[model samples]
Target: MIASVGLVRYAKCVLFGASTPRPEPDSGKVDFSAAAAAEVSVPADFRCPISLELMKDPVVVASGQTYDRESISHWIASGHATCPKTGQALAHQNLVPNKALKNLISLWCREENIPFDVTESEPNAVTANKAATEAARMTASFLVETLAASKETDAANRIVHELRQLATSGSDVRSFIGGAGGIPLLVPLLSSSEPNLQLNAVTALLNLSVLEANKKRIMHADGAIDGIVCVLSSGATWRARENAAAAVVSLSGVHSYRRRLGRDRRIVAELVNLVNVGPISTRKYSLDALASLAGDRENIRRLVESGVIKVALEAVEDADSADEAVAVLAALAKRGGAPELGVQEGVVRKLVRVLKNGSDSGRANAASALVYLCRKAGGGNLVAELAVVPGVEWVIWEMMASGTERGRRKAAALGRICRRWAVAAEADRLAARYSDVSLTVASSTRMAVAQ
Candidate 1:
């Protein structure tokens, strides 16, 4: 054990080009100070060549290359006979535990204040379901600690990337990350100038928010929503912005969270911007978040006020976003924003076009929005205008014929409004024409009588 500690100090000296006096074996503890541990980088040999992460359990295969036990086991299980690093064919598929290296890594982790349980790292330990869960929990705790202590941008980026991966693994692991206090640490990195760090941090939050408990934890964390909004508005990469929007969608799943997000005009504006200008996937995510926000009545007003109607109108023309855009419009209309939505230039026309030629969902939502507009006070004029659109009547007929039950109901209602408004408009036109003929005849009779 003294020799192993000596080896660790020598390896650190070689890697970091600094030296410290060897610890006395009688002390039974490594003499490295916390300051020294903070400065000591992980030795190259201590990291698994495959994962490039500190090895929890080091193992050697036939080619004499050391890798993390879990990593090498996965490699062999994938039917690869050759060593990953050397590409040399394995004479046998056996992995020998490098107990000395494992001990060195353990001592190094202890000195660095990183949690690494040797028992958890054993291959047989992971075979049991409970052991695997515990191992994930410990791993999450270690990652959270590393992320919190890391000052180097590159190191922080790598740790966050790993946290993102772990958060995505399963709901249990996501719960573990939240329990490990990873949410607060990740919230600050959402605004990181390092592009990868910001991207990974926001994405990890998105993954963590999949669990209901983590969603509350994330929202309650200070500056969490602000950090996410900053990323959504001006992130370093489009993917970062996209993931930030996705995080909003995840958080907006809760009613209270949705209302809180909806209160932020910046959040609504950014979502509208993304719906207007982002790529297909980004637009989809932004629209999804907007849809959730629109569930609140006040949010619907904010969305409409943020020029979302124009964005949705433009998006309705896109086959990729037609359904989502129309869904948002439907939500807005259903939530008392019908007057605002109905007044937008070309909105009715665009919705009619969607009803005629868009996807099933788009058509249904368009139908719903139109029905809402026609039900508002003084909506007969709007209905009259809709009835004149060339294909709207046929579209309504088709919806009633082949649409879902809800679609059929909306279509039937719209059809009745159109027919009623059309009849009323004709009656008004006839009344004006009749009055005109009477005036003309009266003028003729007066002129004849005066002559």
Candidate 2:
């Protein structure tokens, strides 16, 4: 049976141009050319061993020394190379060469004096030497076609289609718009009553506006900024607000819009008002935009003075718990402007109150803000006194026993506060004995439940 099987294999190889003489069973010599030719003959072997394609998105085979489109392609097709021998999936870190393919390539390269270049961007050494100019030309042509397709009147139902086309077109969309004549194509869609149409148009514009040319178009279109602001200002659907926020975020990135957001002041006031009165979704988006702008120190100071901080504080006071307020507070704390605005001006006190009594999220953000404020407030006795308010300690202990990640993060933050507030020994002991505390807390809570 073994002899018959070997004869059948030899017959198939012969049909496929395998020209080497079959070795006797005792022959130790390996036949390189015949094996290489046989491996190459099966186009399936030529398919990407990873993706199983004809070397599309090719990766180096695990043996780490060869370059055969066929072998790599085969590995992809067979799915044997997905997980390593130990069963760990082929993550980005475990990449190695396909030994057979590498040996073949090295043999071919040695014979032909060709160097293999296999960087990710140059995965196919055979194709790597192709002219960049030629590739760019093809890419530009693709973008032009896709840009045309995306402009179809019914872009609403075709968003996925448009997105795929846009992505494939590469970066030319921005470069082309930066040159000239693209704004006219993108502006009208902003006013479309159809939410999806407006969303796609705004998104496309946001993408294209990254370049100088499209930004000029935005300013040239007298109503583009107003239209975006209107969408943001209105109680449009969440998707619309998200799109509007994205576009606004993009426009705000342009120097042309900087004055509009800052010196001109109208846009800032409107955005702040949205933070106070817009729907919860709209408010979130508005605050996100504000947070982005506040990266500029002047903008941060302006927000502190805008009365929005008080409004946010009041909202936290009014919430059933503090989750809704935490995101905003975390952003403010991250900006580190509390001292300049005066923590003693009531924000700090209220935040400490929230840290002691607010919901898990609120306490976390408030705790974070307190840490920043204490450092900024010069880490004096006043801060320590505030840190250990009876109420705050009670809340911290309660949160340390909670199950949520936010609860845990809050508890950790509180522990840091305890250490900083001259309770370092206690905090250290607690850290060293966390397991005991956890068990005690669990048992006591359960017994309390039984009682």
Candidate 3:
């Protein structure tokens, strides 16, 4: 084992020659021929006992077991190679180049007349080298095509099974089909002439969109957004619309994609309108996408100017739909950073009122949003107003008082806010009362804090 480790170290040192930095991401073709052409004479000990060869196929000499050369080479390359007999790895330096290849090499040497001298000769063998290189290249090309076909076939199977699952299962079966390529394969199917396949494709893409990476690719794919919107405008089934809206919601999660949907008339005019007009379920996800994208500053101004904010605000007012108010408030807080916009006129006050009267989750979201808004607004006045609002102080006080498990969690968050506020307010009062002394104290305190 120690000898093997030493051999590996020596081999790496010789091969890598001082550990140079890796090249940047490949832009041009990778010259595997160049790499294969670089090999020198095979190491002596790495020769296979069975063939007494240079280990042409890299057969594994494992615990009374032998692997084909290709299998052994692949395992070694992946750092998975082990001796079949002892389960110990071969020394990294002990590369078993094809020695029986000597006959081939000698013929090539005579034909090509490249010397055996390392300083003067080309490294590749003469006879079998060209055949080996061609075989490897052809095999790699074939493997790539095979994998692509397999992915398309698997996607078709997923589409069929997914439809049956969608109809019979209680929840969306997206989590079951996981892969970076799933979205790409299913996108083309969304526009398939076959209705069942088209429906299943939409369902699959919707599920794929739940993942951030998949959604990025789906949106970037040619005509994907337009195809989905066309489906929406064509009066597809509610299930289809719901899934489409979910995909839009996923796309909207990326801020840069806001404008991608703008030019698609089916999206802006048809789907955006559905936030207020579609069936209850469809409207929910559609509004969610609209609300999230509305938080993008330019998109927010565009949406508001287009009169969509009013519709969203109205939804917040409906008694049966008050649950959505939290989402509306959160979105507005994100888009409308300052209380001056509309936070002062109504949003904050309404959220504050809800803090006293709404359900626990709603009240929690409202309270969190108010605190966030106040912090962003950055004023002593806003802080004072929040501190003294009817039930606001008591709510915080009760939160700090409860001492239950959840209450303890809330207490930690509130404590940090209160601590910062206390320090900032005290610094202001001291600066006014004892200007010079306050400067000295603040400096000393700052130094101490830094320490």
lDDT-best of 1 and 2: 1
Candidate 3 residue 158 Cα shift, in angstroms, is 11
Q: Count the backbone clashes (under 3 Å) in each candidate.
A: 0, 22, 8
- The positional error of residue 289 in candidate 1, measured at the CA in angstroms, is 2.0
Work out the TM-score per prediction. Answer: 0.67, 0.44, 0.44
Return the top candidate by TM-score. 1
Model 3, 350-391: lDDT tens digits are: 666655665443554455556556666664556655555666
Q: Per-residue lDDT for 448 in model 2?
A: 100
Worst 10 residues of 3 by lDDT: 26-35
**Model 2: per-residue Cα lDDT over 300-377, one tens digit each:** 566666765665666566554244454455555557666653444566567777766665445656766666666665
Relative to the unseen true structure, what is the C-alpha lDDT of residue 432 in candidate 1, on a scale of 0 to 100? 100
Better of 2 and 3 by lDDT: 2
Deviation from native of the Cα of residue 442 in model 3, angstroms: 42
Candidate 3 lDDT for residue 451: 100
What is the C-alpha local distance difference test score of candidate 2?
Answer: 0.49
